[model samples]
Target: MAISGVSIFVVGIALLVSVPLSQQNEEVHLKFSYSGETGPDKWGSLKPEFSTCSTGKLQSPVNIVTKDVIYNPKLQPLNRDYRTSNSTLINHGYSIGLFYGSDKVGVMIHDGKNYTLKQVHWHSPSEHTINGIRYPLELHQVHIADDGSISVVGVLYNYGAPDLLLLQIKSKLDELAKEACGEDEIAKIPIGHMGTKYLRRGAFKYYRYVGSLTTPPCTQNVTWTIIAKVREVSKEQIEALTAPLEGSCKSNSRPVQALYGRKIELYNAMPNKI
Candidate 1:
């Protein structure tokens, strides 16, 4: 089943009011970064809660080699329910994120489980690579299950014509980029539409693996589905995404982690397959 765009907008508004501003403000000072003392390598040491960054064996952003992937006909096509919604643009210090309102909910169905969309964020010089080749940008749509498990659907962007969704938020991004850190006023954005465009039209082929969050806490048991087909975004869009992060960190991506013998399943579209 699919969700309507108007329903998504209403839910987003509900979520925004449910969360108090004070609580969100308090979380803005965690002090993590992409380089120097607070870099990825130092994440575990900076805070006790972030120890997983250095110690976790199942870390994410691994290099995906096509030759090493096992074809899985059983993997189901993603059932995405999304729509345009009001969103807030935040400069999280480490990366830029577009967050949905607290009451809003979008879901992705896979293997009989449902993961609700929470927010969308970007990383430059793409963290996950295809056969060791990194793209100009990467987009991550973060989702959560009722049990709080996380699943991130990743899309890599190559240089090309501008993306309509990116263009819609370009002005807000530029404004946020000017400030070192903080959030802009809430704006209505077609987030669900943006996500749908990528997930629905692309080659259904994707690489799946279990890994930890790319950020601190580095919590494990996260599911990742990275679309094999690349998407297009303009050079200007790439600049808008990365410019804000340039002053503090050389790059916003974690170096590709070791596969650690983890098996990667390539979900291929086959007739009469699940």
Candidate 2:
């Protein structure tokens, strides 16, 4: 089932001009111009249809301060496919075809009905905004189910203290190219071994919306969830993730969009029982 009316991307010819993105061209490998010409700012300028970006309201990446949230919706877990073995290597930048460690963390909610776990990806220096502030990085866990509904789980990272799991992955990043394996190889990565409890702890807030990829061919239909807390990484760690190999762009983050008319949800004001 399709989530947004817009067709999901497919593996096509390399529009990357650089990294290997996903198996497909439009997947996550396309180059994004963040400013003028082919950049993010120029997207709407490029096409009349893209006017929404500059005009439409309800943009994503709201800040996470405490708010009074009333109703606590009961969330159900569906089928989980999280596994370290699920990791795969895709070209993101010139030298950064890093590895992604996704081992179906378990379908938190899925039925042949609404939202189901699709896949997840990451964005350096975050692609979302929180109270007009931006974080260092954001992890987007995209979920789409039966009839075209979308829900995303967002994990935010901050400066300061570093996370072991992340550091571990960072340590092995140099080996990412060697870590590249087909689906079977990905199936061997250990996701469950890494602790995720820290991710859900504390005053975790979220922001939801119907937005598109911050990058090129920016297709919409994404329900975002930006976590309030931030994870830490050293300057060296950040370098590991951003160091473009040979010929490539230095940064991979998209600039923040001005909020238009989207209503922000201060989800989880009340403590959720895990």
Candidate 3:
């Protein structure tokens, strides 16, 4: 669900991006761009493993038609038991990723399954849209279950007051941006005891759906949970997040994909429950 759209984002307020712990998963080394021959349109054919990118019935980064969203009472609040972990910040040429080094950082309990937290990443101009509007930034909290199933909790951000999460790592991002442009070495910052709570922005309400991985090898059956409330982020914060990827141009968002009969459900949390 990494960014790749055509329009300059318009935040009427509503998101996603995920850079995996391994560079291979983010496909950073892959020859895919937001446009041109190796762009999103050509992802499925770039390699045999990426065939799902073109053929998957339920591709991600779908526009959430709020009116059509079925309010599922059974849907539960997002339960993430994240902790402080020894983490590494890697500036993959295409994205900035925060990776957990421990056996597990934490887990989110959904449908009684514990999806272990893996990594978090950002995408500019947002990937998912709300009511046909796109936000300035999106943060993805990616997790996986014992059976290899995936669950991503997304938080969308708009231009406003600075995000504390970005504030903490701004300087590091600036340094990484220079390293990414240099091409001699990948910037790997060993930031100790980083916690994932910084990613928990927005309201308790969220929209849930079954979708594919936003990036290539576009795996299917991944669960997506997008926070309903939009968080505040300043333009400077957005700039810091995208700086490391300036070599590839500022736009990294993937355009919204066809819904293909997939159902989007909203989890309206009970008062004081979330």
Worst 10 residues of 1 by lDDT: 7-16
Clashes of each: 4, 35, 8
Candidate 1 versus truth, CA RMSD in Å, comes to 7.8
Cα lDDT of model 3 by residue, 1-274, tens digit:
1233222221110112233333323323345557777678888998796788899898889999998988888888777777778877775555677877645788898998998877788889899999999999988888877776788888888899999887877777776666633333356777777655776543478999999788776777889999988999999888887776644446778889999888999888663543
List candidate 3 segments past 4 Å from native: 1-29, 180-185, 201-203, 270-274
Cα lDDT listed for each candidate: 0.70, 0.45, 0.73
- For candidate 1, the per-residue lDDT at 77 reads 91
TM-score versus the correct structure, for each prediction: 0.82, 0.62, 0.85
In terms of lDDT, model 1 sits at 0.70
Ranking by TM-score: 3, 1, 2
Q: Lowest summed lDDT over 10 consecutive residues: which window, candidate 2?
A: 1-10
lDDT of 2 by residue, 2-119 (tens): 1221111211111221123232223332233444465556655555645545554443444433342223344232233443333443433322332333334444443344443434
Most TM-score-accurate candidate: 3
